[model samples]
Target: MKGTIHKCLAALVKEEYGEDAWKKCLQSSGFEPERNFALTEDIEEENSINLIVESAKVLDIPLKKLFDQFGVYWCCTYAPKHYSFWYVGMKDAKAFIIKLDEIHGLVGKHFNNAKPPRFLYHWTDKNQKVLKVEYQSNRKLIDLYISLVNGLAIYFKEEIEINKISEHEVELTFDY
Candidate 1:
C-alpha cells in the first residue's frame, strides 16, 4: 500500500511546525488542496512507492502501520499503474488524530507499532462502539470504515451507506 506521511513531509522542513506550515509545505510541493486534506499530483512509477516507503521511514511510522493506514489505490498523472498516496479527507486528519490519540492513548501506542490490531474504539454520537475491521493492508481508513459499516449492518440487521469520510472519521446514514 502506498501513502504519504504528512508529518514526515512537514518535518522535512522544520520542527514544532503548526497546521499552516504543513499546508504551506504541501501546497508548495504541488499538492492540491482538497476539502479536508491536500492532494498532490502523484507520479505513478516505481519511485512513487519508493517515496511513500521513504516517507514512512522518516516519520518513524512503521511500514506495516503505514500500509494499514493508507494502502488505498489512486490514479496519478505520472503513473497509470494506479498507485497509492495517503488518503486523507477534506479536513486535516492529523488534528483529529491527535485528539483521538489523546482520548484513546491506546490508539497512538498501537498505531505506532507495526503489528497493531485492527480495532477502533470510538464514540458514535456519544455512544461507545467497537469496530472490528479486516486486514485492509492497502486501503484508506475511510475504506476501512465503509467496510466496518458493512459488517455492522449485518450485525445490527440494518442497511446503511457511507456518505463521506473526513480526516477525523467517516459519516454514515441509514435508510429505512
Candidate 2:
C-alpha cells in the first residue's frame, strides 16, 4: 500500500467527519493521533486495512460505505487536485479507465516497492459499449475497485451499468 492512499483517507475523514473523528479513528487503528503519511511513502498492508476498518468503526458506517465514499473522494477530488498531470488529456471515464493500467505502471516507477493492481480490458460488444475488466491484485480489494469504478462514472457524469462477473472481474456497460 502507498501512503498516498492513507493520506487521502485521512483527508476524507477529517473533511467529512471532522478532525476529532479522524484523530479517534487513527488512535483506534493503533496509530498516533497526529501521524501523517507522506504521499510516496510505503505503508504496510495490514496497517492500511486496519486504518480502513477503524475508520468505518469510528464513523459508525459500514465498511462498504466508507470504501464508496473514499473511492469517490479519491477519484474525483483528491487525485485530480494532487496529480493533475495524470489527467492531462483524459476526456472521459472510458479514456481514463482504458489507461489505468499504464498509469499505474507509471506511478509504480516513481515509488519504491510499489505493487499497484493490474487491469486487463476487453470489449464485450461489437459496438464497444460494454467492457469486461479483469482486476489482478494480491490485496483483494475488489469492493474498493468497484467503488472506484462507480466514482469514475460520477466523475465523468456518465451512466455506467456495472455487473460483477466474479470476485476479480467486472463488466461495465457504458452509455454513450
lDDT of each: 0.37, 0.92
Give a tens-digit lDDT track for model 2, residues 99-160.
99998888778778889998999998898899999998988888899999888888889888
C-alpha TM-score for every candidate: 0.25, 0.97
Name the 10 consecutive residues with the lowest summed lDDT in model 1.
71-80
Q: Which stretches of candidate 1 lie over 4 Å from their true place?
A: 1-107, 110-139, 165-169
lDDT of 1 at 77: 17
User: Top TM-score: which candidate number?
Assistant: 2
Best by lDDT: 2
Clashes of 1: 9
TM-score of 2: 0.97
